[model samples]
Target: MAKSKVYFTNLRASFGRNLLQKLEKLIKEAGIGNIDFQNKYAAIKIHFGEPGNLAFLRPNYAKVVADVVKELGGKPFLTDCNTLYVGRRKNALDHLDTAYENGFSPFSTGCHVLIGDGLKGTDETLVPIDGDYVKEAKIGAAIMDADVFISLTHFKGHEATGFGGCLKNIGMGCGSRAGKMEMHSSGKPHVNQQLCVGCGSCQKDCAHSAITITDRKASIDHSKCVGCGRCIGRCPVDAVEAASDEANDILNCKIAEYTWAVVKDRPCFHISLVVDVSPNCDCHSENDLPIVPDVGMFASFDPIALDQACADAVNAQPSVPGSILDERERCHHDHFTDTHPDTNWESCLEHGVKLGLGTREYELITIQ
Candidate 1:
């Protein structure tokens, strides 16, 4: 395969053009205009920053994307699936509230915010992929419904997948509750007795009657549990711990397969902002100091090459002083691996290539 073109622009703004203008220019130069967006529903996938985390992409950036989509004659909306953990965005209601609270309001972004998985994180579209890891990918129904898919990612580190880039935003970000359960775990979930408050929320939400509360503790009967991941979202105290036994490499492969399910039958575009550069995913309520200085913005029609280019750009930068990457042993020589020794982010990009998502080799086209 030929090297895909990945367009880039450093974050340097002047009187004539600002960062938002630069972003609009970057995507257009990257060939976003090539996609026919006329009279189509475009889903602009993004993370709305866990309430207290300041590292998420600002609403202004989303507005730029939305405005561009509208100028192309498409209806655009900001979207993301409910997270699979106990947080502000675990359900649609809470998710929207958090989005509004964290500067992702429709008024702010010039587009409506739609929680991808719907009310309870159960609305999904099952797409058959039949990969080595996943047989079928369960993506959020609303995300799959869009005529065009665009990822506006805040490139950053993650404890599980090393760095959360375009593929991570689309794959794991698009998965519904059960979908996320499929990718993260290989077995039935269990309860964390220590965190159980016996609220009966899980028991009431379980469709298979698999959870029972006794002596102020909830227990799961794995035989009856279908692993729908409903309890994990419903539990008020986060006692229903997901069984995340899948190896990181398998997890990455599953993520790639899930991404394939999302973008396969649609016109897709990707943009990643290497700003804030947090040490973990924006899912965390709080963000740590950036491991590296703000790199800039990247855009590509090829998600795999987009991710690869972003990773390479980040690796080329010098580490920030008094940050996690700086404090780590730095033995891996690769910033991502040095910061997250247990994670191999390349697994996702490699699997993406095998799945025909895009090539890792990219021609970096730097623009003003």
Candidate 2:
């Protein structure tokens, strides 16, 4: 009910201290050391930029967090779940390859990278949280096994959720394959006949015999199909796609509930870097120019407050020249809405508040 404290620091440096050192100072000042990290398995959730997308947070920043966790005697690991889309990171092996390719290795980050959902994207631990929408959340087993959870987010804009921040990183990013399917769609995946080569990959992978190949084309029997999302991942030709039919508002709320499933009964912390400010998710293989100038770095015990502060800071900045925000008509005073007219990002934070995640009101304390 009271205002949460969100700590901040701008991107400035002197000879004696650099940005990494500043990040170390910022998190400690924000009370990361207050958690009992001794001998605990800590999971620092992050997005290792999809192969070609260069806007993701660099591994150097992750090293700072890992070093601090080690200093406190905790076992720390960088983690993220397998994505649902057909990409380089759809399964554990490929996901690790992408992470290493993006320069995130135990050698670079001072820790290991764990694909939260395991090799097939089906390894999950279901947490029961009876909410208005989701009854149970399927999260990656490794993520849920951690005694402590921390979100190290690359704050940026998204076409669906409006902005990807702490909650998005923890909620949607932690979901296993089925969890992502549930959040993104109300129905099972369907085949695009034009794209299907009828390789019978989906047919062979379907555990329920829902997929059939006829005349070099595939069709799914929805009645027999369970939305486990295996066929979407197994398709070699990218012919299968999840039906993104959920309303953006409903999707936002589901993300909040999934976040609750992840952080409940666990010690958690959050940090967001409002740099790059990419106009779309890092899931894309490419990143556009930043829509706004870099704001700063933020840390907080409250994920809701951290997200709200980051959004407010971004909204206050002037739009970057030639970026999407600058090119838009600016009809909506809110930058996120003006850039993505159909999405309502406020729905996530409001639902987070209603679900007792954290308070939106915050006191922004600047750390020089």
User: What is the TM-score of candidate 2?
Assistant: 0.96
Instruction: List TM-score per model, in order.
Output: 0.96, 0.96
Q: Indicate which candidate wins on lDDT.
A: 2
Error of 1 at 222 (Å): 1.6
Model-by-model lDDT, in order? 0.93, 0.95
Candidate 1 has its poorest 10 consecutive residues by lDDT at 233-242
The residue-by-residue lDDT of candidate 1 on 16-131, one tens digit each, is 99999999999999988999999999999999989889889999999999999999999999999987777888899999999999888878889999999998888999899999
Error of 1 at 72 (Å): 0.8
- Report clashes for each candidate as comma-separated counts: 0, 0
Off by over 4 Å in 1: 194-201, 213-217
